[model samples]
Target: MMMTGSALTDEAAEAETLVHSTKTDKPRRIAILSYRSTPHVGGQGIYLDYLSRALVERGHDVDIISGPPYPEVDERVKVIEIPSLDLYAQPHNGHFALRPRHFKRGEDLYEYFAHLTGKFAEPLTFGERLKRYFAEQKPQYDVIIDNQTLTPGLLSDALQKTPIIGIIHHPITQDRQLALDAEKSFRKRLLIRRWYGFIAPQIKVACQMPIHITSSGAIKKDIMREFGLKSEQLRVIPLGVAQEDFHPRDDVKREPLQIITTASADVPLKGLIYLLRAVAKLRDDLPDLKLKVIGKLREGATSKELEALSISDMVSFESGLTREELARAFCAASIAVTPSLYEGFGLPCAEAMSCGTPVLTTDGGALPEVVGDAGLVVPKADPEALATALRTFFKQSDELKAELGRRAFERAQLTFNWSRIAPVYETVIEEAIAR
Candidate 1:
């Protein structure tokens, strides 16, 4: 059941139940800090938004502290907005600096330059805001957990001592390595690496924290190896999917010979290029096959690859969709693919499965761990293997279609509902406070 109180209380209770609970006091206060929330941009934010709301449902108080691309939260949960220059707010065309976001000492300019230089600045800026917030008014919250804003400033600043915990979604190091491998030019690789350099502070800070948490052990392993951290330092907690929102839709028509994918269409780390090539190869065998992408199309290497492959005509791009529209897309899809080079948690794969759509995922980081036996698995950056899998799905359509969908639906129900997840988070909050 969905928690009715707040993220802190709900997850705290869930955590307690997972192990063994001896405490009688219910957790009252919770703080979840993140750089950006989703629907404003990506899945991380959506994860925070829904999970927080679910927590609130379970009778806990939740406050989300976030930077640019703020979260869309329920009225019950308090949102502490930490506004940045937000250069990447929307359509950041050439004339951004003079837009006048007023600066005490030109924090906006520094951020804009950082973006231009491919250096991520949100963690640093958010750290400054958080430090200021704590300095101005310190509240006696039961627990304070950061949602993947692993910057050193949060740990180093005076804000470090307040029953703090870190919620690392997953380390971004795997994304960096995949990107560097995908880069066509040495200069491109260098720029990508530079952008990822922002994670250094996160690595440094994880060492000192009493509680460090992640969504999956797959992710925990990755973070430990990449961040030079120890496995014992982290607590693994898997997040749940929103079954009601993601489940099968009988109203929507499932297009035959159609496939769907949800991710940034432009990012190289997502392996959109690999998917596109696979689609092209499969289209030759299944001549009427088509692909629909649910992410914004960008002018990047992946997009360029799509154009070069001559399969641009076969693919449909749609962005800026509400959750309902996205669900409709999932319902209409015959098969869903997650061709990422790496992932900490593959939300889309689970979401699609919840919608009763069969999934095919690449062995990119934690994707296989997430997909398990419910979906087909393939190698990363391999068009031939993907094409073969797609062809098999179509060739055995009648025999495997509903069977695959049924298995997927069952898996999603057992593992992904938000009601089930929110309480677990509540438990973690209590555990953190106890620590």
Candidate 2:
């Protein structure tokens, strides 16, 4: 039988796609670097775990080279431990961790003094350890990717000979500015500047890299502007979601007038204070309104704000929840909220959407990019706006809420799942190796 012209064209396109997919599916040895990778502490751990797992699933050999508080990754991916002083893990903050033994080594002395002076020296210290480790181990990798370390050691000629990419989630400059703006004391402001002194080295390292990966375009632009790099230097590969681990639980009953959010840190950047105030404002009219924050409400400005607002009784906080437990928290809530002042890729927002929860998020950084049209968007740090959005959401009937959840889940399947995102990463890795 003679094939029609359209049928021939379709066959040709299918063949081209198959060829491209097969080329990308070819395995390569990959090394992922992370200074610290504790999931609840920050997104670095999550990124390393998910990306390594996704890449390995695509038939790549993946290993994580990390410092203290190492990442918990998939069984197939190996984790190479590079120990630091683990200063943060010590009592009295990092002060008590310092000892006469630290004085014996130049790098240890630098780390100890820097921490005592309120400067974050982990990245540099970790880099020194990484350099020494590489010198001794001499492991081979086709491409190496650093997760937000941006250390001087990455620029070492030994490692630079390999195809290396740096992942800058977002500019720490933004975080520094937000912290400065939040603090009123000059001494504390000075300390904030001191803590972020690593940004200078980070910028230097980022600018020298051959290629970089940022989670969102918003972050890519920020990196270019902050690190003095051109747009071509950066690749925008949005983060992935573990959809299987965070799917809808229809058997879990949703709580009435209850809201859930994940704010791992009680910082100004998280915008939890605004959400607290909004909850305070809405609780009178909706007396049953309750909030469950998936983070510790430590004694700090946020806790003090809760006391001032007198809404402490209306709010509850939890931490260290497993992924399945977190999904259940999302399922049981009437809606999920992420009121961040800024985000690199808004992984929590994507997680909520994957769980088929209707989300109400602030248009901060890449959050709007993550939520898109599936969830409600409010301006960041505006209690009035947040409260209004909450009120509007609560006013909706159960059918509308379920419909929103369905849309969120559908959107997650189309855009946020790892099955689609992992290949983009492979393409970038291949390009770096070829270059």
Report the number of the highest-lDDT candidate. Answer: 2
Tens-place lDDT per residue, model 1, 45-99, is 7788777887777777899888767788789988888777777654653235545
TM-score of 1: 0.90
TM-scores for the candidates: 0.90, 0.94
- Candidate 1: which stretches are off by over 4 Å? 1-25, 90-103, 106-109, 156-158
TM-score (C-alpha) between model 2 and the true structure: 0.94
Candidate 2 clashing pairs, residues 3+ apart or interchain = none
Top model by TM-score, which number?
2
Give model 2 RMSD, 1 decimal.
Answer: 7.0
